[model samples]
Target: ILIDGALQNLDFSSGSVEFHNLVIERELNQKVMGGTEDEIYIFYMRFRRGIRVGIRLSKKILLIQLEIDSGFRNGTLGLLGTFNDNQNDEFVLPNGTVFISGASQTDQNLHLYGLHWRTQEISSLFKYDGTQSWSSINNLTFVPLFFNPNLTAFIPNATIRRYAQDICYGEGLNDPTPEQRKPCYFDFSVTFDADIANDTEKTLKTIDTAKKTL
Candidate 1:
């Protein structure tokens, strides 16, 4: 929930594209552990050049896995492309419980995504390329512009696998556990096309009239 404007206040301006299409959606709610499990998240997109993604899952869920991690700093965890709604497997090992820190102090280099779905609505459409810099912490002069949508989930119950051991036994342990509990609630919305290849059919009828005005 740190989305720092990739066009946060979109307006097709009477139709005449220039934003370059992108519509990522999310509404994933996991109910503790439920049989098959595999989930990881890190979506920080504010345009870094790489677009063309169309993934919609919510017919009661079934998108087994999708991995796309590019330009991530701290030991370059590279592994790109792996989308499936049914077949094509192989790409599920965040076993370290997948942890990613804030772009390692700017120069923004992170797009780590590994999602295995059983569904509660998770949509996608990609195409990004913001001067591709694959950031590698090279004496950061000043790179302070960020976008965010970080999510992480790996199921097997035990209160959702003790979220990193309840943040290391509740840090300074004020000693008073058992009260925090949340199970499901998520909502999403993202529709864009400031420049749809110079007006592709009136930018899909102005993105279907701005998604029926939401």
Candidate 2:
């Protein structure tokens, strides 16, 4: 999913862009892959700048794999969010899966392709900025935005809250009381520095046009 108004041009002369603070989460229905009916969810959030350049592709891929279970095959794809003023193109994968992809100056939008009954299903991908405003690519409904409490299977609730608060407020800080703290918001940002200068604009326009027909 691409976030609106999150795109920016960098001064890097190497034809590469850097993204910071990207949060990617995926929820896979286990039944689709011959597993239990429960959903297998994975989330990745980067606090520092993440390299989107060519040479670091391997490292990035490794980072993604570390967060998710490797037993789930064909689920290795990662989501990209960006900011573009115009609508973007709808991508058709080799497996007959199709979905729209785009970016904007402040929002990131994505509609992920899934498999159901051997056919492709598209999930609504949404984005929220630092302000916590949300937007979706289509009229797609999403699961709850909050983290899955089950992620910390054996961890206690107090420990989870402490970790969450530390990550949200900053490290090396005392925990705050319930009244003094608020739920943490997941923020994401993206940058594209491809040689194609108008990629962002073109993608947005394409997405807008496609939306009318639906």
Candidate 3:
């Protein structure tokens, strides 16, 4: 799905969708120090078997080009989606994406958040990944991203990503506490780096944040 941009043409003959090479944001210029399409943030993603292997965006590129300065903020961010299994007590994002715990954060009392691709809701921004963030599916990666008001973008730190991947892929501790009698969830931070821009275009960056446990 290509958000923040308009498709000028579309074709579906080759078992794939094709665009006319014109994304609306590309037509705008910000030379006059005012309003322009250049200020609009664009996020382009192509999914393959539930994994986002490719992405195209304007802001992330701009940030690298400008090199305005960047650093990873404290805290881990995770990516969450709809739980597709027959599990109960699931959390749903505003966009109707349900999430199951394919991986765990380092923090036992992890915060969870519901997310829609493009939303202005606080739920989309942050939430605690508590008990409600679990799914019955085995060996599925559930990565999540948290919104950082300081950076004005959603991102996750490397520590959390590795931890989540380990737990989700069955590479971490598998013991569960007697109270819950279930495997323990991993914990990590949502820290990320950014060029520190108020404009959405310069702040938004693509990342493979969090994942679910097996």
Candidate 4:
């Protein structure tokens, strides 16, 4: 069976069909200004097998990629993971791909979105690791440029911000008293760009202002 572009709920009885492979893809584009367009594509896949009637599981490969194009500059980013089962009972794949034992289930949920901005460019990418909820991984911003009198089209400075969030839940500690468990959240942000025309400061300030208002 094939599912496309949405979430699906499925249940199977024992000795039903077996899951072979799973694939996911997302593509997005953003037009900044003056006919310059930035495009992003992300692809991921999981390969698994069942062993000993749910006593052991095996995974082959996991991969992800990001491609960006903005008329003048183009770049690509990619990630790959391969699992080697030596003696461990369970293992978690790099890049947040999880492998579980003793559970016989499969699910697929995918989402895609596109946005256009005239004054500034904005783009975001998110993924759910199955261990926790979904969260954004990459965010980009593009700044406008103007031709200087030196007969050169000076590229205005811009900042590319990346963030990752993780949540951990604990049941309770040995306090001997009644207590509630809450999820611990971890979030961090990093900015990357070169300083040109003082545009980096301006763009960073704009982001800060927007966050304060929200």
Better of 1 and 2 by TM-score: 2
lDDT of 2 by residue, 42-151 (tens): 33333244422111121112224333323433433324211222234234344445354543211222223322212222433444466654333322354323322332
Give the clashing residue pairs of candidate 4, or none. Answer: none
* Tens-digit lDDT track of model 4 for 46-155: 23322111111111112233322233131111111123332222223323343432342111111111112111213223333445332232244423222122211111
Q: How accurate is candidate 3 locally (lDDT)?
A: 0.30
Residues 1-214 of candidate 1 have per-residue lDDT tens digits of 2133143443334432233454343333442222333342222222334433323333233233343334332322214323433122223334533333334422132322322221122232332246432243222344332322222322224443343223322433421322121111011111121122112333345676899999
> Where in model 1 is the C-alpha error above 4 Å?
1-8, 14-48, 54-88, 95-214
State each model's CA lDDT, in order.
0.30, 0.34, 0.30, 0.25
The residue-level lDDT of candidate 2 at 180 comes to: 26
Better of 1 and 3 by TM-score: 3
lDDT for 51 (candidate 3) = 24
If both were scored by lDDT, which would come out higher, candidate 1 or candidate 4?
A: 1
- TM-score for all models, in order of appearance: 0.17, 0.20, 0.19, 0.18
Regarding TM-score, does 1 or 4 come out ahead?
Answer: 4
What lDDT score is found at residue 88 in candidate 1? 26
User: Taking the tens digit of each residue's C-alpha lDDT, what string does model 3 give over 1-214?
Assistant: 3223332453333434533542222212333111434443323223322222222344333321211112312111233322334333244444445434445432222344422333333434333234322233222446554323221121145454444334323355432321121111211122121221222222122112222221
lDDT of 2: 0.34
